[model samples]
Target: MKLGNIEEDSKMSPAFFLQRLPAQRRSALHDVINIRHAYHKLCEICEEVSEFYGFTIFTDMAHNGILVTLVSYFLLVFFIGMIKVDLISCISYGVIIVWFAFQTTVLTSYVTRTIIQIEKTANVINKLIRQCAMNKKVEKELLNFRCELAFQKVKFTAWGVFSLDRSFLASSVYGSVHQRNLIYVKYIFFKILGLAPWKLNLVTKPSKNRTAKTIICKFSYLGLLYNVLLTTSVFLMTSYFCHQHNSVQAQVDSLVTPSTMMNLQYFAVILSSSVFLNYTCRQKDMIGILNEIIKIDKKLQKYAFNSAKNGNIIINLIFLGHLIICSTLICLQYFFLQSFWLAVLRCWPAFLYCWLIVQYTIMLDMMEKRFKFINLNIVKLGEIKVNSEGLEPVSATRISFLRESVLYDVVNIKDNYNKLCDICNDISDFYGLPFLKVMMYHGTSTILILYFMLVAYYESKEFHLLLFIKDVGFVLWMVFQIIILTTFVNKTIDKIAGTTATYLIILIQFRASTPN
Candidate 1:
């Protein structure tokens, strides 16, 4: 029956009626009242699980599980649909597809049912309210209960990116599939270079030996040896080339000037050596920084809806494209001066240097995102919604909520900001010397390349298209890297300043509105 009709007919609320009933019935009502407390406990358990599993850094287990199953299902379907495989292969694919489908169905059905069951409590509460007349206190209690249910919903999310519900199957499948190739490509590249920070586990269980082994295995000491060898080889090759072109006339006659090539060679050597030092000598500090980042992300989860979108795929793709184009140009330049093998070996230093720069840029981008998120939260604290009337100040209730919830959030934000600043400091300390070398090299190289390009254009009888293109490309590429790095640095600083200003504004407003 409708709630209005039941209210008209009822003499007393079901809760009041229960008070008059036997102790046995009252005891049962006590159990019903304890559901909220039970739910709170469940939430705590889930959070603990999330922390243990490092779900904050990556997708939750459920999302990964579902995504894997769906991908496998699609792959099998495609193989079977194409009808290119033999009978046995087709049969195997069919069996696997069926199993995957079953798993997906069971998972989705169970989660959907759990959600429906939780929602059914509201209906139960409404039934109780309608069964008998509710006194103001009982009515208020029921209203509060409903409000709690409305505000505090239990949702299963994949790193807070998307909810895991019926509709999630399609979106998750599509999204994972779309980004899979680029993600794998970048993963492989970083993995090969041994510069992937994420290779180290952020969340460690209480096993020191196991953690140590993982660190060693993932970031092997061999990387240091490899870098040393590469740096030595580049230095030797550059020296050999310089020795062969001892005369200024010979160097000038060459397609790629010895000085320009030497600048790039030294630049590569510095970057390679820095990467080696970062992974070997400062491995512990690097790991500590990553752990701090994870901690910051976990805390920021309360204030932010999703992880920072640093556009890893897009950024990596751009870097990869640049690598291809630059490598091709460098290879062409080298072909004229040295043997094929030596030329390829010479390209290694440049490649490694570019990789290091890309990784560095990505780190800065992530930090900038965190700063922006913090600034956004601070701005939110100062915001007041307005209506058709001139201005509507935040309600006392809203202000109280902010004091209870966001006041602590403000403190945490401040702590996170400080931690980020420290992380940036640590980063600068680690990369400062290498970055200085890079700046010096780039500045000198730019000037030399421009002057040479002008001389080559004006003094030479014929316009060398290849040399002109290479010079222009190198200058533009260096400028682009500088611009990107500076942009992120400036944006991060702006965000930090904005956060401080907003925080101060809110504090002043709070103090001004308070009485002695």
Candidate 2:
């Protein structure tokens, strides 16, 4: 039942493991595919030994982290299922109503705390450990212990910290990305089905003949598609809710006023906006991961192919294109929230969406690692195809190309940092072990506490929140209209692709036409 032995670990290895392993202990380990490429990227600089042998901190976790998160999520869901609506209302009236301000404060504090944890944890572990071993007699155990220490910190830094804390009352960043994609995908096809929007500028910048037509025919369609998808979904949903509220108000007009209907609508919009915005930074991280990976691959080509030395390029691919996408989501939410209070409540569902995404990331990270091992093993055992593509087989042309990529003709680690330093590629400059320990130990637990505070605050004043929503429904309803109109109008190809003069002209004409 207990998997504590190399025998079990060997069982986890791919068929190719027997041939590829330099050390038996490092062979035959469990695989987690989610972010293995990212690990491969990071391990380049993350490795501590003079040997340049890289092992991913995440890939080696046997994927227990994801399992743990899932268990936590299910429990949270179970508790929510037990909550009664009337009880929520009573609590909201008595306690939560009094604490809305405090909840806001807590949310602010939590987001800040999580960011700090990330900043602190992304350290150059290999450099630090080599520093420790420079003068002292290096024991094998010490090496292992030091490596584990640095890894423990990464276990809870940046995204890890974000995932843990952000999941408290709402969902996870992962969930939000999925939702945005789903919502946008559905909307685009149903209403604006033509071509996908060209997100980048190279395609849009005028160059050859008929640039306007090119922009319209080639790229505008994609933007329009996304716009149509989002607009249709938001407007349709808003219209449905507005219709339902109108019908209910007809029956209860004597009891509640139109102003009351508007307030409740506002509250719901707040919830939606919050959910949408959290995905912003997530998109940035995705890009970071990809950039790191590309760099690592280049590094490997330069260092390993020419010489017989085993070079592990430190490319943390997990930080790739996803970051940009997530950041956009965050910005999207921010704009949505700025429009109304109803958008705030949407944070919870967004958080839920995030939690689910984190779960998959963990799973995929595991799977990628396993497959990497299988690839390595296949190459080692000569099981690879004669045309084996990715396995970096040694050849003259490959070695020559690799040499060109390196900063210098030299490839020795002894000279580079004068210590066991790996190239750590990240946006942040500050990273260390103390920061990591703090993150790993505090990241999840801290957010959990904050989430609890949020829940408790809400639970206490359920009635007031209901009343608040009831009072501001129409103002909130305006948010739905805003998202629909702005998304559709701003994204319009002809309008967006217009020259600066066009915008000025439109602005002037509109003002001149006004009754004021």
Task: Assess every candidate by TM-score.
Answer: 0.55, 0.23
The CA lDDT of each predicted structure is 0.61, 0.34
Residue 175 displacement (Å), model 1 = 5.5
lDDT of 1: 0.61
**Which residue window of length 10 is worst by lDDT in model 2?**
307-316
1-516 in candidate 1: lDDT tens per residue? Answer: 233343444435677545544443343344445665786676566555434544553453455467657656665455334335567765765676677567656766765676677678777767766674445544556666677777656655546656555645544223433344444566567756655533443234555454311112234455556545654666677567545644522225355666656565566555665665565566566667766787787688676434423344445556767666665655665645445555555555545555666767767877877888887777675552112111556667775665676567767877999999999998878767656766766776687678777766678656767667777887887788777777877877787778778778877866665557
Q: Give one digit per residue, the lDDT tens place, for model 2 in 245-327.
A: 45433312333466655554454333333322222223343334333433333343433321111211111122222333333
Q: Could you tell me how far off, in angstroms, the CA of residue 443 lies in candidate 2 after the best superposition?
A: 36
Which regions of candidate 1 fall more than 4 Å away from where they truly are?
1-188, 194-198, 202-220, 232-275, 308-321, 334-340, 383-402, 512-516
lDDT of 2: 0.34
- How many residue pairs clash per model? 4, 104
Q: Which stretches of candidate 2 lie over 4 Å from their true place?
A: 1-62, 79-198, 201-218, 245-256, 259-516
